[model samples]
Target: MQKTCLAFAVVALLQPALNLWASDASLAVFEKRILPILQASKPSSCTECHLSGVELKDYIFPEQDKTFAALVKADMIDLKQPEQSKLLKFIERRPEKPSLITDKVRVEEAAAFREWIVAAVKDPQLLKAKSTASVGPQVSDELIRHARKDRVLNSFAENVWSEVGRCAACHSPDKNQAQVKKFGNRVSWIKPRDMQGTMQNLLDSGIIDVDAPEKSLLLAKPLMQVEHGGGQKMLLGDRTYKQFRAFIDDYVAVVKGTYKDAKALPKLSQEVSQVSEIWLKIEGIPKSLDKQFLRADVYAKTADGWSKERVATGDRAIFGGGGLWQQHLTLTAPRDSARAKELLSAQKLAGGEYLVRISIDRNNRLAQDPNSDFTKEDVIGEVPVRTNWPSGYGAMTVVKLPAQTR
Candidate 1:
């Protein structure tokens, strides 16, 4: 009984020393492996998931004890099972197709954190350490999520990728082989059907000026504010230009971390649209309306009367001398609606009778204010037409202006 009592006393006396030794070892691991991550000039593994606003170093500190304590206080470290630490889980999260270099960095970062966390949790001193210092990003969770790569990509797809068709003839790798031979591969800014690759190419080619978004070559070149080999592909206040600016401006804001809350983030449009090959022509346009912007909204004839929403829309400056206005149509639908899903797979206007509402910008409002949109007051007339909306410039559906206006 005395021998057993003495054995218990020895362990009780050595407990504090053992904890101190274990704590020192854990601190060594943090200083050697983890501190390098904090001090490195390059971004850590967090870049794999976050474009900005968050980094692995945000959870670390110069002082090991402070970092351990803060992480503990924030519930980032799981004492019962250190391997299941939230910080480790966060570090492990990766995109579907991560860059090889970043993936390597991610592996190293996860291993370093796992080693330190496993050892530190076993040290009673680290478990008992207390700290008031914050251990993660200073921004709100909403901002962090907004800065995620997936979210950024989705925004790119909606605002910029959807408009690439306007530039694809000269910019896409699949179609710009001749341009590449003359202008070098630099002109092939777009990857074939790869949104992420296209975005990266834009960034790498200095087309997207995050620092001065308005001055970006991507916007300036298309607007003809800068010399462009493709001539003027987009007007200053046209739908294509608006969509590009919306994406570039928002991308700059996101990277700069200017938004304080979710409300500050830019709102997405309720409607979705896609450029299509379907064309429309209106004859007998007045010479006075020449060079004036004309917009046409096509509504499918439904059992009730017409679709509550326009099925397709097209806009362009009228040709006064030709006494007609012609442009390709853009399929439209409310986002997330059944129509939107259908348009996603196929951009075809079904064969049927339709009502075409025409609006004329007499005051040049769109040019004066790019943000201005057509309203009921802008409607000049409505013409009824019946035809299968075929695809191609050669198969354009033709209609005449209302007799009153003609």
Candidate 2:
């Protein structure tokens, strides 16, 4: 009886922790790591203004959204570049307000905030809103092989040496600038645009279709023959053209679900799915693992709303197979599941697309290492789920997975 009571009490305690784990991964870490800093400071009610939520809410820039929040959590900001980062300016309050703290608590909080800002500035994902990897056309391997072979004929490199094909002479892989005297001082350029905004504009103007191959510039650009002002055509035969094409495709994918007009990316809310099977294997858990962590609950949405579905009990449900130290979690996306249903439910549109969001909280111990001091909740990396359903409804999930620390 005592063992049963103890087990029940433990399960009750873990329920909320797991729910928080499922909700927003960063929140758990954020509240744990930074809440003390904020509470300790106790900003003045004076200064002729009052801001809500410990840290002057009104002082924080309006542009810093959830993604930025992750950056903050991760502590990837540079304190010196106030103009470049709002967090630094907000915290230093150097030229703004040098006289807010009157106690040790406030002084310590201010110092911690400054240290976090410096670290946050170094995170690349926070520095730019988009990623920069280029995976070229969606063609088959055979097509890629053929394309490579065709490049051997009077290749752009050969032309450069002969003083004709100035592709390499001007746009050197080293310094991506033009070699003015050699290439007539002019090179065709496609300036990077806010990919999410550009795609939204095209969609709103009816210039593209979500599914139609003809609607996407990605599908059409390769075959375009018109001179691109500087005399380069979007031809499949040009190696230079292929490089630029690949860059644009990747930019589009990163912000695929982001809407142009929405000030920030929208949060995901629900996913529709039906239960198929369950698996559990955390039986004789090892001592090294954090046993305080419990099994995560899986859920599916329907006309009635999100319904709880059992997957596995305790840590068995956690996807944990990646060889050595690698770990992962298993979750289902309704669309990929065999038993998805489209039932009408109230929709909330934040950005352009519809999305399902997962909410969960987990624990993190802050005192383990001094280097961990630089970490903050807002800087952690996240994966976004964005979709457009045939029924005119959409869903998304802004995922916060465990950091793949190298």
TM-score of 1: 0.94
| Predictions in order: lDDT | 0.88, 0.31
- What TM-score would each prediction reach against the true structure? 0.94, 0.17
The local lDDT score (0 to 100) that residue 168 gets in candidate 2 is 30
Poorest 10 consecutive residues by lDDT, candidate 1: 232-241
Determine which window of 10 residues in candidate 2 has minimal summed lDDT: 310-319
Candidate 2's residue-wise lDDT over 1-406, tens digit each?
Answer: 9999999999899986754453344333334434454344445322112111123332233232343444444343433573355444444343233334433434554555454444434434344443232222233443332233122221212221121122333333233454444444223221122333333344454333344423344324333432222333222322223333333332232224222332332222133322111221222222333322222333333367444442111121122232111111222334434332221122111123222222111243221321122223313222232322112112222223433411
Candidate 2 error regions (>4 Å): 1-166, 170-224, 228-234, 237-243, 255-406
Give the runs in model 1 whose Cα sits over 4 Å from its true position: 1-10
lDDT of 2 at 150: 23
Instruction: State the lDDT at 164 in candidate 1.
Output: 84
Question: Which candidate leads in TM-score?
Answer: 1
